[model samples]
Target: MKITSQNKLLLPVFCSAFLLSGCWLDSDDDKAVEPVELATSANVRVVHASPDAPTVDIIIGGTPISQKLDLDYQDATAWYAIAPNTYEISVEANLPGDDANVLTFSPALVGSQTYTILAIGSVGQGTLEALVVENTLTPVTAGNVRAQIVHAAPNAPEVDVYVTAPDTLLSAEQPLATLAYKGFTGQVEVPAGDYQIRITPAGSTTVVFDSGTLALAAGSDLLISATQNVVTGSSPVSLVVATGAGSATILDKDTPAEIRAVHAVADAPAVDIIANNALTLFDGAPFKGATSYIEVAAGDYLIDVAADADNSIVVIDDAAITLTAGMRYTAIANNTLALIDLDLIIDTPRKIATAAQVRIFHASQATPNVDIYVTADGEITDVSPAFSDVPYATGALAETGYVQLPAGDYVVTVTPTGTKTEAIETGVLSLAAGEIYTAFAVDGDMEGAAPQLILLDGFVVPQAN
Candidate 1:
C-alpha cells in the first residue's frame, strides 16, 4: 500500500496505533517505516488600513502577537509564521487607560498559504471592518518579480496606478492598472529594478499620490496597497507595500493642511481672507462668522483680510502664518479695527470615546479677567465655574487646557471672578461624544459691542458662532 498526500491524514492515527502496540521489531523493520512529512506552516501579515484609528496592538489567541505596534495610517506589519490552525485575532487601540479590542476575527489558516488581515474603514463612523485576503506567493520567472496592488482607501474613488522610473512625469506616463475601493489586482510580472509608483484619477492626468522610489529585488514577490492618509487633513489616499516574505513599507505622499478663517472682530466690516495677498482663501466672512475648513498645501503664506475679494482695501494686512502638515489651524481676525490683529491658534483635538474635550480661548481684548462656567443649560446659576479666575492675557494667548466632560447640552458663561451676577458672554452648546470643542469669548467693551461666545467645533470649523 502506498501513502500519498491525500492519505497523509491517516498517518497520525497509524503512528498512534503503532506506539500503543509494544511490538518488538528488528532494526531492518524500523528502516522500512519511513517518516511522514506534515503540511507546511502558513504565513500571515497584518495591515492597519483605518484612516483615523489610533495605533493598535495585534493580539492572537489572547496573547499579543505584535506588542505596542505603532502601525499608524497606511502602516503594515511583517509576516509571521503560524502552524495551520484556527486563530482568534484581536486589534486593540493604544489609548490611555484602555485595553479594549476595537475589532476581532476568527480565521482558520491553511498550510503553505499566505494571508493578509487588514483593519479597514473609519473608526468613529462605525464602519470599521476586517478584511482578509488569500495571497499568492508563487515564484516568478528568473530576473523578474510578481507584484499585486490592493486598494483599501475607504474614502477614495476609483484610481489609476502607475509604476514608472524615478522623477517620471505623471502626465506623460500611462497607468498600470485601475482599481476601485477594496479592489485587488492579479499578480503581474515585471523586470526587477528600481521604480516609482503614482496614483491618479481614472483617465485623468492629475497625479494624486506619488511614491518617490522603491527597489524591487529579483525573484521577489510584492503586494502594494492604497490606504487612507490620516495625517493629511483632506484624507487623501496613500500607499503601503508589502513583500511576499512579510516585510512592509509605507510610501507616504504629500497631503494638504486644514485651515479655517474666523471673523471675530465685532467692529470690523465683512472681509475676504486672502492667502499671499493674491489667492482668496475665505470670501465674504462677516463679523462673528467662520468659514468652513479648507485644504491647502503645507507652507507659509502672508494672510491678509481685505474688505473685498479684489485684494484692495486690506483690513488685516500682511499677517505671516506658517501652516504645518497634518495640523488644523484657525486664523481669527480679532479685536477692533484700531487694534486689529490676527490670532493664529493651533487646534489639536483629542477625542475620547465617551466624552467631549472642551477648551476656552480668550480672544476678546475688551473683556476683563473673568471666570468661565461650563454647566448644564439652565443650571448656570446653581453651579460654580468650571475654569476659575482665568485671566484675559496670561503671557501669550490666553487659553485653557482641555477638560473632558460628558456629552450633552451645556451652557458656557463668562463672568467676573467671584461673581456670576452679570454674565458677559453666555451661550448654549451641545457637545457630542467623540468630539472636541473650543469656546472663544469675543467682542470689545460690552457697552460698545455686546460680548458673545464664538463656539468652534475644535478640529474642524465652527458649527455655530
Candidate 2:
C-alpha cells in the first residue's frame, strides 16, 4: 500500500499568491485543477509477527514517531511516505519480553510524487530505503560506515541490530558517519587500528551482535554483516552478530613494553589492555602517551616482557612492590626488559547499621560526597537516624559522617562542594526497613579516582509485640 506525506511547502506558496492579488489567480482561471494528487516520494515499511516481537518506534531526526504497520500476512496493507528530500530515519523497539531491534535509514528522496511501495512478504525482513532522488549513488569514502536494510525473508521473522564499537560495546564517540539501512550490512571508514565489530539483534540481552574485530587502515572500506544473534532465555528471537573484514583495529593504546628482564621472578604475559577493565601487569615502561592508567585491586602480580634481548634492561619506580587500590604507576623499557612504577592507595568503604548493629560496606572512590535520603516502608522496629560526615582531601581519603534513613530505595549521591572540581555520581540503595546499609561516594575525576563500593550483610533486631 502507499502513504502520502503532506507537502508543507506548497501551502505557503498558494497563500502568498492569493495575497498578491492575481499572480496564481490568472493561471487558475486559464486551466482546470487536477483532481488526482500524486505523491512526491515514499518510505518503506516492515511487517513482522512474533509473539515476542517488539513494537517498533520510528524517529525522524531525534523525535519519536509511530511504528511501521505489523503486516503479519502478505495481503495486509503496510507502507510509509517521505517528502522528497534527504532524511535520517531511526527505528527502535525496546520493551520487556520483546526483542530489541533498532535500525536506521539515510536515503535521498525525490519530488516526483509517487509511491515506491515495497512488497513485505517477499522480503521477510523489513526494508529501509535510502531513496536516491536523482539515481545517483552517494560516494562513501573509507572510514565511513553506513547501514543497509535488505529484507531477504518474504515471511521471515524480524531481528534486532545496532552499530557500535567492537569490544568496547558502546558506539564510538567520533564515528566517521552513521546512517540507517535495512539489513545487517554496514560500512565504516577508520584509520589503521584494531577495533571490535559489535552488532546486537532482537531477543538477546547482552551484545549478541558480531564478535569479530576490525583492523581498519587509512582510506579503507570495511563491510560488516551478521548471520544471526545469540539466543538467551526461553524466547526465540533472531539474534545476529556482525562479521568483520580486512586488517582494521580499533587502536586504543600502545602495547606495553616487555617486562621479562626486570622480573627477577615470574614473567609477564603479553599485555592487552581493554578500556575500563581495570589495572593490569606492569611492563616497566614509561606510560608517557597513555590517556589513562589502570587500577588493579590490592595484590601482587607477575610481570613479563613483550620481547627479550641479551643484557636487556627495564626501569620502574621500584624493583618489586605490593600495591593497593586507587593509585597510578608508570612503566619504562630498554632493548630487552621493561620497568614499571607502582602507585598504591587504599579506598575504604563506609559502615552503616542494619537493625541496630548489622553493617554493610560500599565503595565511594570516584564519588564526591555521599548524601543519604530516606523513605519508610513501615518495617522498622527502631528509629535511630543520626549521620556522620567524612570529607575526602588530596593525597588523603575524605571521610563523611553517617545518617540513618528509613527503609526503601534511598538515593545516595556524592555531591561535591567547596573548590571541588568533580561531577556527582548517584546510586539507589534499597534498605530492608530495619536492615542496615553503609554507602558513600568517592571521586569521579581521574585525580580522585573512581569510588569503591562495599556491602557487608546485616540484619535488624526483631520487634516484640
Candidate 3:
C-alpha cells in the first residue's frame, strides 16, 4: 500500500521520526527536501492500541503507511512527519479480501507541535475509536528523562499509578496519580534511573498491575501507556513503553503460561498423562481427544504418559518441557505406537476482532504428506490446496502458522499429497470474529479407519501437584 516518491500527491509522504529526529522531511537521508515548508509541520506518531484488532493499514490520503512494517496490536511507530493541516486518514483492519475500516481521524495539526495518534478500544465491542493527544515539545533537563503516562485500557478500572524504586513497599508510598480510562498526565521530567511501575485500584493499596524493575536512561523521552493485557498473563493491563526509537511491552512478573495436551499416539490406549512421574496431569485420556489448556506457573518440567496409570507401560517418559511466562503452547503425543513422540508448538493468541486466525497441524502417523484446503463449504472440485505436501509432525508441531481469514462459514479438508480424496473434511464451521482455531489431523482408532480432524483449543499437559 505504500507509494513511490514520484507519486507524493496521490499517496502518503509520511517520514519516520527517528530518521528525521522528529523533524519534517521527505526522503530518508535525515534531511528535509523542502526545508521552508518543514518549519511549519507537525511531528506525529501512530500507536496501535486496540487489543483485539488485526494487523492494520493506515491510509493517509490514499496510501497505506505499512509498506515498511505492519502496525499490529500493541505496536507503535517512531515520530513521523505531516503537514500542519487537516487531512483525511483512516485505519483499516487488514483482512483476506476486503479490509474493514475500523477508525478515521480528521485532526487539525498545528505547526510546531507534537502529537500521538492512537487506535484504541475493542473492535468486536463496537468501541473501536481514535484518540489524538497533543504533546508539548520541550527540552528535558540534563540528567533527567521526560515521562508521559496514559491510561488506555477501555475496560480497566480507574487506578492509582506509581513509578517508584523496585521492591518499594506500597504501604507508605504515594501514587503519582489516579487516572481513569483514556486519562493522561502532562509531561513530567524526573531524574533518570531505575524504577518500578505499579497500578492499584483507586484509593486502595491492593496492587493489581505490577511492572518489575525498569531503567530510565538519561535524556530519554518516554510515552508509557497502560493497555489491556492481550499478549498473555492474568493481569488486567501491561505497560507499553514508547520511546523515540521503538516500543516494548512489560508484562507482570507473575504472569502464568497455559498448556494443552493432545492424545495422538496412534496405537496407545487411554493413557494416564503424568508430570515428573508423580503428578497425574490427565487420567484416562482417550485417543483423538485433547485436554483443555491448564494454567501453570512458567517453568521447566518433565512429562510422562503411561497406559492406565501404570508407569511401567509407558509410551512417553520424562520428556523435557519448558514454558515461558505470558505465552501459550501446545504439546501433542504424535507418531505411531512404536515410535510415539511429542510435538511442541508455540501458540499465537492475539485474536483480531475482524477476522479468524486458523492454524493447521499434521499429527497423524497413518497419513503421509498432505495437501490441506480451507474452502467455501469444504468444496474442492476445482480449487487448489492452501497447503501442499504438509508432512507429519516429527517431535515438533508441523504446522502452518496462524492464517488470517475473513470471518464466516468455511470447511477444512485434508487430502493425501496430490489427490482430491479427503483424509479429513470438517463440516461448515462458523468461525466468528475475535477468535482463534487450532485443527489437528489425527490418526483413526486402533481398528484403522480413515484419518479424521480433531479441533482443539490449545495443547500441552500440565505438571501435577
Candidate 4:
C-alpha cells in the first residue's frame, strides 16, 4: 500500500475546481491561526563500505531514490538522505570478488535534522537530512495501478499474481513489482498502464490466465479471478490498485460431471458394456476413486472391463456398457465370476536381523526362477526351526510381485530362477511391524528392477491378531 501526497488531496481539489473555486473565499479576517507543531525531523546520512570500487542501490521508504554509486575499494562508502519521519531504509551494495551487502534501517527524523550512518568493513556508512519545504503539486489525477489476484485451481491454494507490461508503461528500471501479502490477498501497485498478468499456482503446471493482458487508466483498477473445473464451491480473487481506471474479471470454468463407474466382474464376456471396453476409456489414465465423468457432447463409449492392473479374483469383470449424454452408469463386480484378485505375498526364509526381504520377479520367461533361500543360524539346511518355506515361493514368476516382512532386518537374495544365472542383490531391508512392499519388473533384463516399497507398518496386522 503506497500513499503519495497527490493521492490524498485529489478528490477535494477536483471537486472545488469543477464547482468554481472563486466562490469559496475566507470572509473572517480577524481570526488568529496558531502555528502547527511539526511532526517530522530531517537529514539522515548513511555510509557503507566498498573495499573494492562498486555500485550501490539506495532506497528510501519503499521507493528507489538514488542512482547506483560506484566507489573505489578500500575507500568505498556512499551516503543518501530521506525526510526525517520514521523511514524504512534499504541499501544494496556490490563489491567485486566479494559477497553483496543488503541492509535495512529504520530511523526517525525530525524537521531540519540530520542523522549519520556508518557501516564499515563490508558495508559503508551514510548521512540523512530532512528539509522544511513548501508543497508544490496539487492533486486531481492521482491514482495507482495494481495486479489482480487469482486462484490457479478451484478449491486449491491461492497463487501469486504477476505482471508483464510494455516498457513504456513502467520506467525502464522498475519493470516488476512484488505484492506484500501471500496468496489471494496480495497484489502489486503501479501507475496505470496496459499490462500482461500471469497467475501461477503453487507447484502446478496449470496457469490461470490463458493470455496475460490487462489494461487500466489513472484512478481505475482491475481485479482478476481464476477458478477451476474440479472445484464445486465458490472462490473469489481480489487485488488492490491505488491509482488508475479499473475493471475486474473473474476467470471461471464449468464443473465437470462426476460419474461413478463400478466394474461388473460377474458379467465379464457376457454383457457388452460400452464403458467396460478398454478402447472406450483412455489407456494408462488414472480412473481411481469415483469414476471421473467428463462432460461429453453426447455419445456411446466401449469400456474394456478386462482384468485391470489389479489382479483381483475377477479380471475384466464386465463387458462394454453404453454411455449416454447426461446419464450415469455403474458396472458391478459380483461374487460369481473369479475376478483374478492377484493376491500376492512374499516372505523371506529367516530373519537375518540385518537385511530386508528382497522379492524378485522373472524379467523374462527365459530368466531363472525367483528362488528365495534361507540359512538359519548361518547354516544352509533342509529343515530348521527358525526357517520356513515362504507361501508363494514359486520356481518361475511373472512381472509384478509383492513382499510382506515382519519388523526386523534380513538379507533376502533375489535370484531369477528360470532365466539369469547372476543374482541381483539388494541393500539392507528394515521393516517396521506390518509393511507391504511391492516390486515391479517392467520390460527390463533380469538384473533391472524398479521395486516400489510402501511402508504399511502404521496399520494393525490381522495375521498377528
Summed backbone clashes in each candidate are 1, 101, 5, 105
Which residue segments of model 4 deviate by more than 4 Å? 1-147, 150-160, 164-176, 180-196, 200-222, 225-260, 264-266, 269-465
Candidate closer to the true structure by lDDT (higher is better), 1 or 3: 3
- Over 4 Å off in model 2, which ranges? 1-37, 49-53, 67-78, 97-101, 113-151, 154-465
Residue-wise C-alpha lDDT for candidate 1, range 1-465, written one tens digit per residue: 000011111111111111112222222222222112233767777887876676688887777766337565555666666788899989887653455589988899888777888888888888888988885434456666567888998889998999887778777877898988888887787876667778888888677776555555555556777887644444366566665333333333355567887877777777888888578887788877887678788777887788854557777677777776556677777767766778777776335454577888877767777788776764567787777777655234477866766677877777877887555645466787677787778875344665677776753465332
List RMSD in Å for every model shown: 16.7, 25.1, 8.5, 22.8
Can you list the residue pairs that collide in candidate 3? 17-79, 260-459, 260-460, 261-460, 330-459
Summing lDDT over every window of 10 consecutive residues in candidate 1, give the lowest-scoring window.
1-10
Question: Model 2 scores what on Cα lDDT?
Answer: 0.29
The 10 consecutive residues of candidate 4 with the worst lDDT sum are: 1-10
| Candidate 2 residue-wise lDDT, 1-465, digit = tens | 011111112211111111112222112211212112234444333332221223345555565534333222111122344556666755454332342334566655565432222222211133322222121222334443322333223223454444344455353333222222233333333333444433233444344333234332333222222212111111222211111111111111111111111111112222222112233343322211111233343334433233223113322322343332212232222111232222222221212112112222222333333332232432212322222233333333333323333344543332233322223323444554333333323222234444433222242121110
lDDT of 3 by residue, 269-370 (tens): 788878777777777777776777778777777888788756689877778877766677776777777888876667776777777788888878787899
Q: lDDT (0-100) at residue 357 of candidate 4?
A: 36
| Candidates ranked by lDDT | 3, 1, 4, 2
lDDT (C-alpha) at residue 396 in model 4: 26
Better of 1 and 3 by TM-score: 3
Q: Supply candidate 1's per-residue lDDT for 392.
A: 57
